[model samples]
Target chain A: AQRVTQPEKLLSVFKGAPVELKCNYSYSGSPELFWYVQYSRQRLQLLLRHISRESIKGFTADLNKGETSFHLKKPFAQEEDSAMYYCALKKAGSARQLTFGSGTQLTVLP
Target chain B: NAGVTQTPKFRVLKTGQSMTLLCAQDMNHEYMYWYRQDPGMGLRLIHYSVGEGTTAKGEVPDGYNVSRLKKQNFLLGLESAAPSQTSVYFCASSLRGTSGVAGELFFGEGSRLTVL
Candidate 1:
């Protein structure tokens, strides 16, 4: 079975400050990781995936195999960044299915 | 395109009552999933279908049943609703399982169910 752990339940930061949302996973085989975000009154949507290796809305994540982590980071925080973020993992197998973390509520204060 | 749409956006049910939630996707994706979201529990998969005419159990499936009779639609049924079943249900779809692991999910607006 695959599992994802997002250590922080809530993270608050001041505008212009750097922020990081930590995430860890445990899977026997190679895993695929992704970040999904939900804004107020909106549907959950994909933020980014490890394979893409691209940044969305100034947020980026690097999958660390040795440490078993895939933390999301942003150089500077913006108030508009406030939302709930979830980290998910999919293991390699014929029935590979997604496993999501508890989620972290990020608050970017002015 | 109506990427993903869930019917009965909000519902209130009584214990022992039955209800069914409908999910439809216009994307022609081959994978559809039903998940329930609670305060601190995040998203827990209730049921999923890899394709039409097939459905499988997910993380939390004991209290739920699913049917995927059509390629573009999936339905979740609760024979007897309970307090624990009151949650925000989300329906999502993706291209295909072999299309790779991180196939981004296109989710619906979600259905808020309250059982009292």
Candidate 2:
């Protein structure tokens, strides 16, 4: 079975501090992982995909095959970055269904 | 363009009552999915459709039915509401890819259902 786990339910960090949201997955086939964020009163949207390897809004995530993890990181946190973040994995098949983790609520305190 | 739209953004139903949640996407996506968001449970896939007239159950499908009579629309129906069924439902769509799996999904604002 394929599963995504976000161990932290809530993470708080002060502005300008570094931030890391851990995400781990268990899958038999190659994995395709993504981070999604939802701001207040906003619909959930894609933050970044491991395949892209590109940073979005100063946040980056590298897929670690050895650890089976795709942790999202940011050099400096911002108050605007506070939101609910979810880690999702695309199943390795034609179904293309997304399996999401429980989610992490990040709070950037000033 | 309305990427994805869900009707009845909010609804309340008594237990044992039936209701249907409609999801429509204007992106002409080939795939549509229904998911329910619960506290600390993340989003669980209830059902999905790859194309018109095709439907498949996902991680959680009990007490739910879906239909894709039209390519751009997918409907999720509940035969009888229950307190456990109360949740925020989200509809998402994605374009088909040559790689066999669909791409990034576009989601709607969501529909909050309260079961009494």
Candidate 3:
């Protein structure tokens, strides 16, 4: 069984402040991790993937195999960054589906 | 391109009534998935298909049925509507990859369903 957990249901931060959304997963096999964002009145889109090792919209996540975590981080929060963030995991084999976390509602206050 | 499109953006059904949500992708993706989003539960996979004429159960498959009769269309059916089934439904598609590596998912705007 594969499970992803986002501990915070809601998080708020002032503009320009650093922000972090925690995510942890439990999967017996090797995993691929990704972050998806849903903006207001918009469809969900991929923010970043661990395999890419790149940042999107100033957000980055490092997969920690030892800790079983893949936390999303941003150097500075912006009002436009306010949205629902979901952490997802995909097993490394034939099962090509994603298991998503509960999600974190990020609110960047101006 | 329309990417992934889900019909009936908003729907309301009475308890015990049945309805089907349609998803169509124009990108010729090999993988299609149906997910339900709730206030606190995030998105749970209802069902998915790896290719045409193939469907599989997902994380939350109970009370929902799906079909992938064609390569570009996936349908999700609710046999009997219930209040607990009310949520926003999303349809996504991704290209098939070799060696289990997955492609980025493209999603539809979503269909909002409410069971009264």
Candidate maximizing TM-score: 2
Interface root mean square deviation per prediction: 1.5, 0.8, 1.1
lDDT (10s digit) by residue, model 3, range B1-116: 99999998999999999999999999999999999999888889999999999999998999999999999999999999999999999999998874333558899999999999
Task: Point out where model 1 deviates above 4 Å.
Answer: A94-96, B97-102
Chain A only: TM-score per candidate: 0.95, 0.97, 0.97
Model 1's CAPRI class is medium
lDDT of 2 at B9: 100
Model 2 chain B: ten consecutive residues of lowest lDDT: B95-104
Q: Whole-model Cα lDDT per candidate?
A: 0.92, 0.94, 0.93
Q: Which of candidates 1 and 2 is the stronger one according to TM-score?
A: 2
The weakest ten consecutive residues by lDDT in model 1 chain B span B95-104
lDDT of 1 by residue, B7-86 (tens): 99999999999999999999998889999999888899999999999999999999899999999999999999999899
Estimate, for each residue in A1-110, the C-alpha lDDT of model 3 and write its tens digit: 88999999999999999999999999998898999999999999999999988999999999999999999999999999999999998887654688889999999999
Tens-digit per-residue lDDT, A70-108, candidate 1: 999999999999999999987765343578899999999
The true-versus-predicted C-alpha distance at residue A2 of model 2, in Å, is 0.5
Report the C-alpha lDDT of model 2 over B1-116, residue by residue, as the tens digit: 98999998999999999999999999999999999999999999999999999999999999999999999899999999999999999999998883433348899999999999
The residue ranges of model 3 lying beyond 4 angstroms of the native Cα positions read B98-101
Better of 2 and 3 by DockQ: 2
Q: Which stretches of candidate 2 lie over 4 Å from their true place?
A: B98-102
Could you give the C-alpha RMSD of every candidate to the true structure, in order shown?
Answer: 1.4, 1.5, 1.5
Candidate 2 Cα lDDT to native: 0.94
